[model samples]
Target: GAGVSQSPSNKVTEKGKDVELRCDPISGHTALYWYRQSLGQGLEFLIYFQGNSAPDKSGLPSDRFSAERTGGSVSTLTIQRTQQEDSAVYLCASSLGPGVVYGYTFGSGTRLTVV
Candidate 1:
Protein backbone atom coordinates (compact mmCIF):
# COMPACT_ATOMS: atom_id res chain seq x y z
CA GLY A 1 0.00 0.00 0.00
CA ALA A 2 1.05 3.60 -0.57
CA GLY A 3 0.23 4.45 3.02
CA VAL A 4 -0.30 2.69 6.34
CA SER A 5 -3.59 0.81 6.39
CA GLN A 6 -5.48 -0.65 9.35
CA SER A 7 -8.55 -2.84 9.37
CA PRO A 8 -11.75 -2.81 11.43
CA SER A 9 -11.52 0.90 12.08
CA ASN A 10 -13.90 0.53 14.99
CA LYS A 11 -14.20 -2.51 17.25
CA VAL A 12 -16.64 -3.19 20.05
CA THR A 13 -15.82 -6.21 22.16
CA GLU A 14 -17.12 -7.61 25.39
CA LYS A 15 -15.09 -7.98 28.52
CA GLY A 16 -12.81 -11.05 28.52
CA LYS A 17 -12.92 -11.27 24.73
CA ASP A 18 -9.88 -11.01 22.55
CA VAL A 19 -9.29 -8.66 19.63
CA GLU A 20 -6.82 -8.69 16.81
CA LEU A 21 -5.88 -5.48 15.00
CA ARG A 22 -4.07 -5.54 11.71
CA CYS A 23 -1.76 -3.04 10.06
CA ASP A 24 -0.31 -2.97 6.58
CA PRO A 25 2.51 -0.48 6.26
CA ILE A 26 3.93 1.24 3.26
CA SER A 27 6.18 -0.79 1.06
CA GLY A 28 9.84 -1.02 2.07
CA HIS A 29 9.30 0.45 5.49
CA THR A 30 11.67 -1.19 7.98
CA ALA A 31 10.11 -0.09 11.20
CA LEU A 32 6.57 -0.60 12.43
CA TYR A 33 5.12 0.53 15.75
CA TRP A 34 1.93 0.09 17.71
CA TYR A 35 0.55 2.65 20.09
CA ARG A 36 -2.72 3.41 21.78
CA GLN A 37 -4.37 6.60 22.94
CA SER A 38 -6.89 6.60 25.70
CA LEU A 39 -9.45 9.32 26.24
CA GLY A 40 -7.70 12.53 27.25
CA GLN A 41 -4.31 10.88 27.32
CA GLY A 42 -1.22 10.88 25.18
CA LEU A 43 -0.27 8.06 22.86
CA GLU A 44 1.26 5.15 24.73
CA PHE A 45 3.82 3.03 22.98
CA LEU A 46 2.91 -0.62 22.72
CA ILE A 47 5.41 -2.51 20.63
CA TYR A 48 8.00 -2.03 17.91
CA PHE A 49 9.35 -4.24 15.14
CA GLN A 50 12.40 -3.46 13.08
CA GLY A 51 13.58 -5.56 10.23
CA ASN A 52 14.30 -9.19 11.28
CA SER A 53 15.65 -8.18 14.67
CA ALA A 54 13.81 -9.21 17.80
CA PRO A 55 10.93 -6.86 18.45
CA ASP A 56 11.16 -4.44 21.34
CA LYS A 57 8.27 -5.47 23.52
CA SER A 58 9.15 -3.32 26.50
CA GLY A 59 6.30 -0.92 25.90
CA LEU A 60 3.52 -3.48 25.98
CA PRO A 61 1.25 -2.64 28.90
CA SER A 62 0.82 -6.25 29.94
CA ASP A 63 1.29 -9.82 28.86
CA ARG A 64 -2.17 -9.75 27.35
CA PHE A 65 -0.99 -7.32 24.70
CA SER A 66 1.31 -8.55 21.99
CA ALA A 67 2.25 -7.79 18.39
CA GLU A 68 4.31 -9.09 15.54
CA ARG A 69 5.45 -7.88 12.14
CA THR A 70 5.73 -10.48 9.41
CA GLY A 71 7.96 -10.30 6.33
CA GLY A 72 8.68 -6.71 7.40
CA SER A 73 5.49 -5.36 5.88
CA VAL A 74 2.35 -6.45 7.69
CA SER A 75 1.73 -6.34 11.44
CA THR A 76 -0.87 -7.50 13.89
CA LEU A 77 -1.63 -6.41 17.46
CA THR A 78 -3.55 -8.78 19.64
CA ILE A 79 -5.24 -7.87 22.89
CA GLN A 80 -6.45 -10.63 25.15
CA ARG A 81 -9.00 -10.56 27.97
CA THR A 82 -10.17 -7.11 27.03
CA GLN A 83 -11.20 -4.83 29.80
CA GLN A 84 -13.06 -1.54 30.08
CA GLU A 85 -9.82 0.20 30.89
CA ASP A 86 -8.41 -1.04 27.62
CA SER A 87 -10.73 1.09 25.54
CA ALA A 88 -8.65 3.26 23.28
CA VAL A 89 -7.67 4.05 19.71
CA TYR A 90 -4.93 1.72 18.58
CA LEU A 91 -2.59 3.44 16.14
CA CYS A 92 -0.03 1.87 13.85
CA ALA A 93 2.85 3.76 12.30
CA SER A 94 5.66 2.81 9.99
CA SER A 95 8.93 4.41 9.03
CA LEU A 96 11.87 3.72 6.81
CA GLY A 97 13.96 3.25 9.91
CA PRO A 98 13.82 3.56 13.68
CA GLY A 99 14.66 7.21 14.20
CA VAL A 100 13.36 10.73 13.77
CA VAL A 101 15.13 11.28 10.47
CA TYR A 102 12.86 8.98 8.49
CA GLY A 103 9.67 10.27 10.08
CA TYR A 104 6.54 8.11 10.09
CA THR A 105 3.28 7.47 8.28
CA PHE A 106 0.44 6.52 10.60
CA GLY A 107 -2.79 4.67 10.03
CA SER A 108 -6.19 6.12 10.93
CA GLY A 109 -6.28 3.73 13.91
CA THR A 110 -8.67 1.14 15.27
CA ARG A 111 -10.97 2.37 17.99
CA LEU A 112 -11.56 -0.40 20.52
CA THR A 113 -14.37 -0.28 22.95
CA VAL A 114 -14.86 -2.80 25.73
CA VAL A 115 -18.21 -3.30 27.37
Candidate 2:
Protein backbone atom coordinates (compact mmCIF):
# COMPACT_ATOMS: atom_id res chain seq x y z
CA GLY A 1 0.00 0.00 0.00
CA ALA A 2 2.91 2.32 0.60
CA GLY A 3 4.64 4.00 -2.29
CA VAL A 4 8.31 4.91 -2.10
CA SER A 5 9.98 7.01 0.59
CA GLN A 6 13.32 8.80 0.67
CA SER A 7 14.97 10.53 3.61
CA PRO A 8 16.61 13.93 3.99
CA SER A 9 14.61 15.87 1.45
CA ASN A 10 17.67 18.06 1.32
CA LYS A 11 21.30 17.35 2.08
CA VAL A 12 24.18 19.80 2.08
CA THR A 13 27.66 18.39 2.53
CA GLU A 14 31.20 19.65 2.22
CA LYS A 15 33.26 18.48 -0.69
CA GLY A 16 35.00 15.13 -0.23
CA LYS A 17 32.54 14.00 2.40
CA ASP A 18 30.29 10.95 2.38
CA VAL A 19 26.53 10.74 2.44
CA GLU A 20 23.93 8.03 2.57
CA LEU A 21 20.42 8.25 1.16
CA ARG A 22 17.73 5.75 2.01
CA CYS A 23 14.66 4.48 0.21
CA ASP A 24 11.71 2.36 1.24
CA PRO A 25 9.76 0.74 -1.55
CA ILE A 26 6.24 -0.49 -1.52
CA SER A 27 5.45 -3.92 -0.22
CA GLY A 28 5.49 -6.90 -2.61
CA HIS A 29 7.12 -4.93 -5.39
CA THR A 30 10.03 -6.80 -6.81
CA ALA A 31 11.63 -3.92 -8.70
CA LEU A 32 13.38 -0.85 -7.35
CA TYR A 33 15.31 1.79 -9.25
CA TRP A 34 17.58 4.70 -8.38
CA TYR A 35 17.92 7.70 -10.62
CA ARG A 36 19.53 11.13 -10.35
CA GLN A 37 18.54 14.36 -12.05
CA SER A 38 20.98 17.17 -12.42
CA LEU A 39 19.95 20.67 -13.29
CA GLY A 40 18.44 20.74 -16.78
CA GLN A 41 19.39 17.11 -17.39
CA GLY A 42 17.35 14.01 -17.92
CA LEU A 43 16.92 11.43 -15.21
CA GLU A 44 19.95 9.15 -15.15
CA PHE A 45 19.37 5.61 -14.01
CA LEU A 46 21.99 4.75 -11.43
CA ILE A 47 21.12 1.22 -10.41
CA TYR A 48 18.27 -1.22 -10.17
CA PHE A 49 17.31 -4.08 -7.91
CA GLN A 50 14.97 -6.93 -8.50
CA GLY A 51 14.24 -8.76 -5.29
CA ASN A 52 17.63 -9.04 -3.60
CA SER A 53 19.75 -8.93 -6.74
CA ALA A 54 20.91 -5.91 -8.65
CA PRO A 55 20.92 -6.36 -12.41
CA ASP A 56 22.15 -2.94 -13.44
CA LYS A 57 24.71 -0.56 -12.06
CA SER A 58 25.83 1.13 -15.22
CA GLY A 59 24.85 4.70 -14.47
CA LEU A 60 26.51 5.13 -11.12
CA PRO A 61 28.60 8.03 -12.54
CA SER A 62 31.76 7.01 -10.79
CA ASP A 63 33.27 4.54 -8.35
CA ARG A 64 32.43 7.00 -5.59
CA PHE A 65 28.83 5.97 -5.82
CA SER A 66 27.36 2.68 -4.67
CA ALA A 67 24.05 1.23 -3.53
CA GLU A 68 22.50 -1.82 -1.91
CA ARG A 69 19.05 -3.25 -1.39
CA THR A 70 18.15 -5.51 1.49
CA GLY A 71 15.25 -7.88 2.17
CA GLY A 72 14.03 -7.02 -1.32
CA SER A 73 12.45 -3.84 -0.06
CA VAL A 74 14.74 -1.16 1.31
CA SER A 75 17.62 0.44 -0.58
CA THR A 76 20.42 2.81 0.34
CA LEU A 77 22.55 4.90 -1.97
CA THR A 78 25.89 6.09 -0.77
CA ILE A 79 28.08 8.71 -2.30
CA GLN A 80 31.64 8.98 -1.15
CA ARG A 81 34.07 11.84 -1.71
CA THR A 82 31.35 14.16 -2.77
CA GLN A 83 32.05 16.77 -5.36
CA GLN A 84 30.29 19.99 -6.29
CA GLU A 85 29.27 18.42 -9.56
CA ASP A 86 27.52 15.69 -7.61
CA SER A 87 24.86 18.09 -6.39
CA ALA A 88 21.54 16.81 -7.65
CA VAL A 89 18.30 15.20 -6.64
CA TYR A 90 18.44 11.48 -6.04
CA LEU A 91 15.13 9.83 -6.85
CA CYS A 92 13.80 6.37 -6.10
CA ALA A 93 10.98 4.54 -7.77
CA SER A 94 9.42 1.10 -7.64
CA SER A 95 7.23 -0.57 -10.18
CA LEU A 96 5.24 -3.64 -10.93
CA GLY A 97 7.83 -4.23 -13.60
CA PRO A 98 10.25 -2.35 -15.84
CA GLY A 99 7.44 -0.74 -17.77
CA VAL A 100 5.24 0.21 -14.80
CA VAL A 101 2.25 -0.71 -17.03
CA TYR A 102 0.16 1.77 -15.11
CA GLY A 103 2.57 4.52 -14.12
CA TYR A 104 5.63 5.09 -12.01
CA THR A 105 5.43 6.47 -8.50
CA PHE A 106 8.51 8.48 -7.54
CA GLY A 107 9.72 9.60 -4.16
CA SER A 108 10.00 13.29 -3.47
CA GLY A 109 13.71 12.64 -3.64
CA THR A 110 16.71 13.58 -1.56
CA ARG A 111 18.28 16.75 -2.86
CA LEU A 112 22.03 16.67 -2.33
CA THR A 113 24.25 19.70 -2.37
CA VAL A 114 28.00 19.28 -2.27
CA VAL A 115 29.67 22.51 -1.38
> Which candidate achieves the best lDDT against the true structure?
2
Worst 10 residues of 2 by lDDT: 96-105
Candidate 2 lDDT over 1-115, as tens digits, reads: 5778899899999999999999998887788999999988999989988887888999889999999999988999999999999999999998877666865678999999999
What shift in Å separates residue 59 of candidate 2 from its native position after superposition? Answer: 0.8
**What is every candidate's alpha-carbon RMSD to the true fold?**
1.2, 1.2
- Where model 2 places Cα greater than 4 Å from the true spot, the runs are none
The TM-score that candidate 2 achieves is 0.94
Q: Residues 38-65, candidate 1, lDDT per residue (tens digit)? A: 9999999888889755458888988998
Superposed Cα deviation of residue 47, candidate 2 (Å): 0.7
lDDT of prediction 2: 0.90
- Estimate candidate 1's alpha-carbon lDDT, on a 0 to 1 scale: 0.90
The alpha-carbon lDDT assigned to residue 6 of candidate 1 equals 98
